[model samples]
Target: MEALLLRVVPGLSEEWQGATPDEIERIEQLAGRPLPPFYRWFLSRMGKSMGKLTYPGLDFSASRVLTCYAEKRITPEPRFLFIAYNSDETMPLHVFYDLEAPARADALVTWGDTWGNVLHEGFETLREMLAWGAVLSFRVGKMPQQCEGIITGEPVGFLSRFDSVMSRLGFTQPVPTGPYCRLYERPDAAMVCSSPSAATFKGGQAFTLGGVDEGALRRILGEIATEPSLEVEVDEWMPELG
Candidate 1:
């Protein structure tokens, strides 16, 4: 998986890091069964760190605390390992591995729009998802290298609210880049929302802002900070994701 990601998307290796043996064992113990070979290989190679490919998008925990916050926050069955999720607020798409299936290198990947809505089954391998995620991250990182900022707030409704404000500003319709993210673009600026990970939920979700002039950025920040129910901090800097 590491070689594939590097080959497919260069410059990402800097953000990648391998997991230790102890970390792998801890995850397997949590699943109550050994993970698929491909998945274990992923953890061994790129589990601890994946740059933009993961961090608020396709977020797989380095801590490997396998828990799923579905319609209600309940413990998932041991056979179902909830590995990653988009925003818990908007269109909560989730990815998991079905341990009950015959063990294979690729594993049976499942996509759930909500808790029970299985939109796709056995549709993609863990490897494929990771590779695609890397591409998306690369594109996001390439956002206009002008003045950048981030809106940080509660994960529950932050992205939804941010999209609304951007839409009203005529930023154009949001394009779903991945299960966890949507990109909104305009002639002079662009914005993307990244779901909050377990590690950063308290600080809130990072809504990346770029490609706008100082005046435009100020206006955008005012709209977001004064919006109906959102309390967010507008930091005039891009988010740093490992």
Candidate 2:
């Protein structure tokens, strides 16, 4: 986890290589309200920066530029969040654009002057941005048609492995009724007996992994026929400049 923090912290592109306690308080003053607990915690852990971490197969990064220490600005994209992280976790500050109505509203809604230089035109307040980056993760969203045995396998690959034993006994995608029918990805398949959460909406088939009972297990497996994988492209935010 610390290693991961090191990777992403650098990508946040914060300006403050070294921050002072007074600087942090000044930001709070500029932002008007107090910082969120989670954000404060993140700051203590990592300073701020445009982060970069290369996993076994994935190379990801994030970066942000500081505009001013005050006022939000509207930009073309909302997810752009008008924020960036430095490559070093020293300072994470809001990205700048000519103040636009939409950008200002989004910056304020998601983080107000924090995204603006309203606090300090430095990365001192990056702790909040880094924290948000940590929690706001996502996966592909093609959705599952059926979740029979809730087996562990890639939905993007060959289907012959799907419930091979059940053969003739099969079912189609279950019609969603209540929240339980909704979708969420598995927490971790590398482990045994893990389950997905129902509260997570329309993400993947992991939510029902162990949700069914022994009897229900058989019933679910019966629904496992198979479907061809149609590759769906995803929009990944490749943070280049911080």
Candidate 3:
């Protein structure tokens, strides 16, 4: 995917729509880490989610972590990741809630508006930090009061590095916040999922949180599924992708 993203140029011709060997190497240099397995597989199925979900306009699954509207190519905004904490589960935390997970008492250190996670709070506190931390700090908005993140990848050692941080904050099992995003200046939210994850979008597209109108949502999703394909440029940026 990084390789594919490298060849992408703003408003370039269609010839630059595919990834080249040189472009891939450049992206690897930029990302530092090689793309993940899922992303690798996702690259094979490029443009699958083309026109599916346009809110975050997520190019691939990983793109939903930030707050940027999706277009035909990567949004100009640099990527950012904010892991939210959930405190209503068992075992190592998995999900990333989009709300503010740290509080006044839970702050590790502050330089004014900088509220850091209390990973130094200790294991139990870490559990609490991930739990009561309002996990939605990753994305700000009025989302479901009780949305849970799906935690896959059994034996998720990815969270081990922060174990000490978790312990310092007095946390146990916490609720998991799944991948989500929000609009620029609204309380609306949009979720990312392979199987038709739908919700009200920034541009007036709306759907119930859950258990409200699945049939209606399904119909809306079906219509959305049929929308025009979202065109993507391999190593180019298009100011007028629309």
Candidate 4:
């Protein structure tokens, strides 16, 4: 999985650093639990890079995860250890590790933004979660709410330019949204556009773009390619339902 991500995502593995024995012991002491072997290996091999994804990665760092756990304990029962958060922290994913059975691999779980309902569960291990590719799928599925806009006036040659740009970036082909518009999606994000003047993009909650011209559209994609968390504010709007 690590090798695949490095090859396909580019720059994702540049900051990876193994955790020290002292760091590992500190986290186990902090959580009052023994870490699962695979998970412990991951921390020791790739903890730093986990949170540096184009989309938000798990808060795998010992200090940050411990801090979040502390914060959550004020109101709710901290039964689960938060492992990752969506780009804006609207959705946090967790794991129910058996503190008593420290070596056991457990399921990954999550709740909606309200934390009142379970959004997902049953991922049996960290490897299973990554292998399933649920992270990207979840991000894409939630994108419509994060950023959306309509292009009022069609701009000339927009579709072709959009296709050329996205295809060059190795994104899947655009899916038709309407006669004049199409939606292009990748594992990490999605975009909808019609002609030269308007488009909407959702990389994550903090990363969005909307109502831009062709020049701006190109620039925004370029910036996103470089830094997926790049944010530009535009008037908030939701996609019109059928």
Instruction: Residues 1-242, candidate 1: write the lDDT tens digits.
Output: 46536744667678777778887776677678868888888877677776546647456754543344423442556766776656667666677776765333655567675354556563335664554445335433555443344555555666667678778888764323322344565666655554432334443445656653456655766877787666656555543322
Q: How close is every model to the real structure, measured as TM-score?
A: 0.47, 0.28, 0.21, 0.40
Candidate 2: segments with Cα more than 4 A from true spot: 1-18, 50-67, 70-242
lDDT at residue 43 of model 1 (Cα atoms): 78
lDDT of 3 by residue, 110-182 (tens): 1110132222212111222222222223222133221222212212332332222223333322223221211
Q: Which stretches of candidate 4 lie over 4 Å from their true place?
A: 51-54, 70-79, 85-122, 134-242
For model 3, what is the error of residue 232's alpha carbon versus the real structure, in angstroms, after optimal superposition? Answer: 41
**lDDT measured at residue 67 in model 3 versus the true structure, 0 to 100:** 18
Rank order (by TM-score, best first): 1, 4, 2, 3
Candidate 2 TM-score to native: 0.28
Better of 2 and 4 by TM-score: 4
| lDDT of candidate 4 over 142-240, digit per residue (tens) | 554334433221234434544565666555533222222344556545554322212342222222333223344445455434432233344444353
Q: Model 1, residue 148: displacement in angstroms? A: 30
* Best-fitting candidate, scored by TM-score: 1
Preferred candidate (lDDT higher): 2 or 4: 4
> Looking at model 2, how many pairs of residues clash?
57
Q: Which candidate comes out best when scored by lDDT?
A: 1
- The 0-to-1 C-alpha lDDT of every candidate, in the order given, reads 0.58, 0.29, 0.25, 0.44
